[model samples]
Target chain A: MKKIVTIAREFGSGGRYIGKLAAEKLGYKFYDKELIMLMSKESGLSDEFIEEAGEKITNSMLFNVAMGGVYLNPGYNNTLMPLSDKLFVVQSNIIKRIAEEGPCVIVGRCADYSLKERGDCLNVFIHCPDEQKAERATKIYNMPEKNIEKEIKRRNKARSSHYYYYTGLDWGSPSNYDIVLNSGSLGADMCADIIADIAKNC
Target chain B: MKKIVTIAREFGSGGRYIGKLAAEKLGYKFYDKELIMLMSKESGLSDEFIEEAGEKITNSMLFNVAMGGVYLNPGYNNTLMPLSDKLFVVQSNIIKRIAEEGPCVIVGRCADYSLKERGDCLNVFIHCPDEQKAERATKIYNMPEKNIEKEIKRRNKARSSHYYYYTGLDWGSPSNYDIVLNSGSLGADMCADIIADIAKNC
Candidate 1:
């Protein structure tokens, strides 16, 4: 009732699915890859750029401080430096844009830290066991078991970095979230239903 | 199935109630006050002394250097201490005993941190909105509105202190928990059912 529900999820954890279902059940708008599209349309940024940067943390004082806050001149053929750097800028705007649109479920891309300024937002982290994630990732993404492990490790590390970069807090800490659910054990449908129920009751 | 579950919750969040329900639904024994009673019996410590010093933390160098290096002294009394300190010791031993007895749902007294070394333990934090907690305190504890504020603050502060003192992590942080539930909106019974289903499936 008084909070916007934001879902932070691990890769292949059915985060987007649960977010969509909960939003639909609660009659709230859902934002995921769609958020990147919206951000692209609004900011005149490319979908590719938006996607790479969205839901990530890029601005590290460590980087700026390390480089002595100096700008490098005439870098050639730098199509991508570190997507993480540009991620915070794009996703921060996207988060604000999504939150401004009204009460909705925004999936991952660091929306939790993005909308922390809003007192009415309820941040949640959705995760399942690693085995579940690996299985799901292998099926959905058509990746090998090793690839799933790599994907999970890489994405989880990225999100954790983004969280630490933006909020100066660990990504999965219960303290940062209003609710944390295990989709592996609960199933995505039940997780969504439970979340929707919580949203309605709130 | 591989891990134990740890619960650190607000005073009136019906932490014990939900924990017991989860254990029962799973056919696992529930350890609440019984844990302390058992530890008291096993450790030759009094109920009163164990409860007081068990949950509190000591900042000695033993725990600081290394976890295995740190030796926990769960005796009745050694020197100057507050009531919280006594509670910490008793609860700590109870947590260890329960974990040794095999997996069980242990509530409050910082059971989560106490059993952190016991591999495969799931840590959970349960919280509700301030308004709901105050209401529960008033209804269950028979306290007035003004008194409710103080009591809630005192208890939450105590939990926070007890948690931070031991974990080296901020209490209530989203990163610190596997799941954090806000039972305020859904109320206690519904909250219990949802968690029960989650645990079963999880």
Candidate 2:
């Protein structure tokens, strides 16, 4: 049986909810937003800063490319790691520590890539159609953007960018995940059930 | 229950074997290469010709673009539909007719896109890691290619191009399918079990 379950998902795909449900079904500890506090405690970084830096890139790719020398130059490199990179290091350590503790569900924060070395990790990616995600953003999350679809796309892009920046892997590629599911079609409950079943059997 | 299960797969993913196992578990009819003969019978095209045309494109995309007018202009059109397009129409009709009859598993030939209007269809995309696929090709299939990985990639590209040319949709994108499985991670048996479970419950 798989011991560690990592869920990487698109924005508004109900992946966190599915992870929580699957964790509950399997009697495993669930970790999502709670990791922000842990990162703050471990890294001595402010919770607010960690929260933002954990899921968003501080600089555009162009800016990073233009300023690459500043990050690598020894003269400018005294603890010169970007906040996002710092948060990623802290978060990855925490994820590793958590995996060492017991079976648990870790959502987002590139946990899939972080725990990839573990033999018993089941990594899943959850996605839904744009319309379904927009509906969820408006109806469930109460997101107030005028163009919810555009907002959804923007958020998804941010998440993808953040993931790729830290992990050097495409965010939602099937090769990185054991299974990928469409929550809009399968519904959150069935997705959780399938995850749990796979965890037990595979 | 999802009565129609359509599987679109990457080359050497063992998707066909998974589909067959799922069909056996669900007691559903399995259709794969058999569609070639059916298309031949329906279109009065030779089985050999249909077999080649059903899964491959005759003209390159550049050639098609350069010669678009020849296919569209009434003066030049007299049943000028490309052989692939003709095969697609026949195969889609047969897919629709099969879905109408009863629960069944259809593998490849873009059945998922063909049965988009059906409420009971479960569209799945199965993929595997390149190394695993290469291993399968060399060991199980006994392929003679010295560079098996390159051959596998070529075949996958062909499948992707054919899918995009006909359906105007990207192959192996999670948004286009209900679920996507990595046979390398989950193994074929567990993948089939997950598919059958989803078909029954969702």
Candidate 3:
């Protein structure tokens, strides 16, 4: 049986690179930025719009507080809301279809929650220490050394909040995932190797 | 800085053994079954009583239904309840003291949630496929093959529900844990070795 593997990762954790390698090694289709393009093509939405809204929630913390509660109804009422919510649903449908097609690796975009009902899905989260993430941002991404930590924290917060708005579950929690790994010591290739092994067996 | 490593695992996953090895590798104190004894001494609870109630909640699925709602009060009201909750608090205090003493590897008993406030803590969950778990039970523990699957499922359910009742969190969610690994593929030693490396650096 084909197994769907979804990876949620910290920024600069090499999750995209690892997912790509795992897909290649397992002879499975890989989705990352390509998922954005796919969603754009399927939903007739602009790629730029989808990309910007992908990691944002319907409301900010300030908006939630102003509303007198931290809770926002997730039900679709057909009223005009943020494009991100629409994009999320579109991509969720796309993800479900992809999983039905065959085994594949999906990186981020809350693919795990999208396919939560599928028994064949294996959700994985990849993370690393802040120092390593900061170093990667500085060395690989050419981010300003002084701002690396800030950028890393900002991106992680965005991802966490985005996931929470959609799933009502804590991001990176083990109960929300089948497998969680720290790439701080293993690096991308080694991490992918382990994931690929599990994917094969699963 | 001293780091505390807490491992939560499936029943037959050899978490305790791996914890011992990791503790030895890092020259840290190892707590497994020994934790029960320590808790008994500190809280004046009997070891056998703590052991039996350790990985259990107030009730199983039946309790969830009878509670009128899925949620139950986690607060203490000065009324008598399950010994498991008391044992949990006792162990939590002991685990905190051990962590404050120095670096150590504590296995099971919701140690991850107990030490969650510590910035120096690394939480890990170890798991494997059912077949692998069954095989390990038969080979390592010399259990009869017929009951392996049933035993595995029952124990995991107890652990999961216990964790939920006490911490109100899923037992193995990556968001609640720092690292998760499949012992089916790597076995205990390799998992411990990888964990020790992280613990040493962390």
lDDT by residue for model 1 (A157-187), tens? 8878867876788787655676788777557
Candidate number that wins on TM-score, 2 or 3: 2
Residue B42 accuracy (lDDT) in model 2: 83
Model 1, docking class: acceptable
Q: What share of the reference contacts survives in each candidate?
A: 0.50, 0.87, 0.37
After TM-score superposition, what is the CA distance of residue A115 in candidate 1 from its true location, in Å?
2.4
User: Against the unseen true structure, what C-alpha lDDT does each candidate score?
Assistant: 0.70, 0.86, 0.78
Provide per-model DockQ scores.
Answer: 0.30, 0.78, 0.19
- Ten-residue segment with the worst summed lDDT in candidate 2 chain A? A67-76
TM-score of chain A, model 1?
0.81
**Chain A TM-score across all models, in listed order:** 0.81, 0.90, 0.87
TM values, all candidates? 0.62, 0.92, 0.57
TM-score of chain B of 1: 0.75
Candidate 3 colliding pairs, count: 12
For candidate 3, write residues B1-202 as lDDT tens digits.
Answer: 3388899998888877888888999999898888888888886766766677677655444643443323322565555544445566778899899889888899998898888888888788888877888888899989988878999899898899889988899886655666797676566777787678667654
